[model samples]
Target chain A: MDLRVRELIKKIRTDKNITFLLALVAVGVFVAQIVYYVQKGEVFSLKRGFQALFLSVTLFLLFAVLQRITKTGKPFDKTIVTLLRVMAVVVIVGGVLPSCVEVFVVVIRGGIYTIDIANLDIFVPVLGVMIGIFSEIFSYGNDLQEDNDMIA
Target chain B: MAIIVRLDRMMADRKISLNELAERVGMSNVNLSNLKTGKMKGIRFETLDSICDVLDCQPGDILEHQ
Candidate 1:
């Protein structure tokens, strides 16, 4: 490989390592949050806990995809595509589920439910859709990469 | 799938080892090996040109439609 290409790969590897470490830190934070809630004898908010867990999972999946890229020196792989798609779905569900649970709880308690437009988080699901689009583009790029490889 | 590569036969007739042909053709041994075994999906015109040049043969000598 050219020196520039090797250098770029090395840089990518370093970045991936940093992201992996950050993901580990996020997982640690999630654990710490659980421990704190247990020690306080307080009911853990399911929505908050689920959101934290999903964030950790999404980060871990991102790390996995980066690790695959570092290993193969290519970003367009089937495994990476699948991981990205899963992450997108996780983000979308995680973002929307809290509001859903809130509404469900209020209805169970016999309270009038109204959609709070001001409190609605539209960004997270939008980000998820953006990730889904990126995964699709990567799938196409993967096909081109395979064709290039076959051409020697 | 109907397209076949006969690189091995051409290399044999040309009395050229894979390593030598790969070096002369500016390609890696693994890629050349893949080409020889018909494991590749397709070949580039540039690569085919190099292989033909190195083997002193025509494209038909290395490719067949089965």
Candidate 2:
């Protein structure tokens, strides 16, 4: 009930809408990616992998926003942290795997397989998941502080 | 954490029935009873402030750290 803490809580709730929207938009983007590719053959390097990363990161961001909104002051769950790890694996497979394959195909079709990594789509879901995981840990730190205060 | 809520006391002081408070607060009498008995873990600040204002007391008047 400290005045400063109370004020911070109020501010957090007010700002939560933005974070929630960001998360929703990210999820929407991922959904669209899948839908577009499946329906229109508009494939990303690795649609599933990219989405898996994007969804993971945004989900983490959502958790961070929820903590602020709820005034719970901590990451509410560990499962989300685990999700970050899963996302990283998916990202590597999604973006890098495709480019690697393309290079291999080019080499098999002709001379030296050029190290053409410039075409790698790095801004996909995997990177998003990393951001999400970081946010969760940041939110968790707040929770840990609250827990300590309560325990004391 | 044993915060004894004295809602029943305020009701008695004001000579208001539990049913009346429940009706005024737009809550079930049973739910109100649970809140009064500290069976609830959380209460919205809006509800808490409203109840205190109507009962003409501070939250501590209705609830206390036991």
Judge candidate 2 at residue A71 and give its lDDT: 56
Worst lDDT run of 10 residues, candidate 2 chain B, spans B37-46
Q: Per-residue lDDT tens digits of candidate 1, residues A40-137? A: 63333544555677787888888888888777778899999999999999889878886676577667768877887898789988999999999999
**In model 1, what is the error at residue A152, expressed in angstroms?**
3.0
Cα lDDT tens digits, model 2, A74-103, are 344454455444545555455455555445
After the best TM-score superposition of candidate 1, give how far the Cα of residue B62 lies from its true spot, in angstroms.
Answer: 3.1
Positional deviation of A45 in candidate 2, in angstroms?
Answer: 10
Model 2, span B1-66: residue lDDT tens = 677778889999988888888877766777788787767666777778778777788878887886
TM-score of each: 0.80, 0.40
| Best DockQ among the predictions, by candidate number | 1
Indicate the residue-level lDDT of B44 in model 2.
71
Pick the lDDT winner. 1
Best-performing candidate as measured by TM-score: 1
Off by over 4 Å in 1: A1-5, A32-47, A101-114, B1-4, B64-66
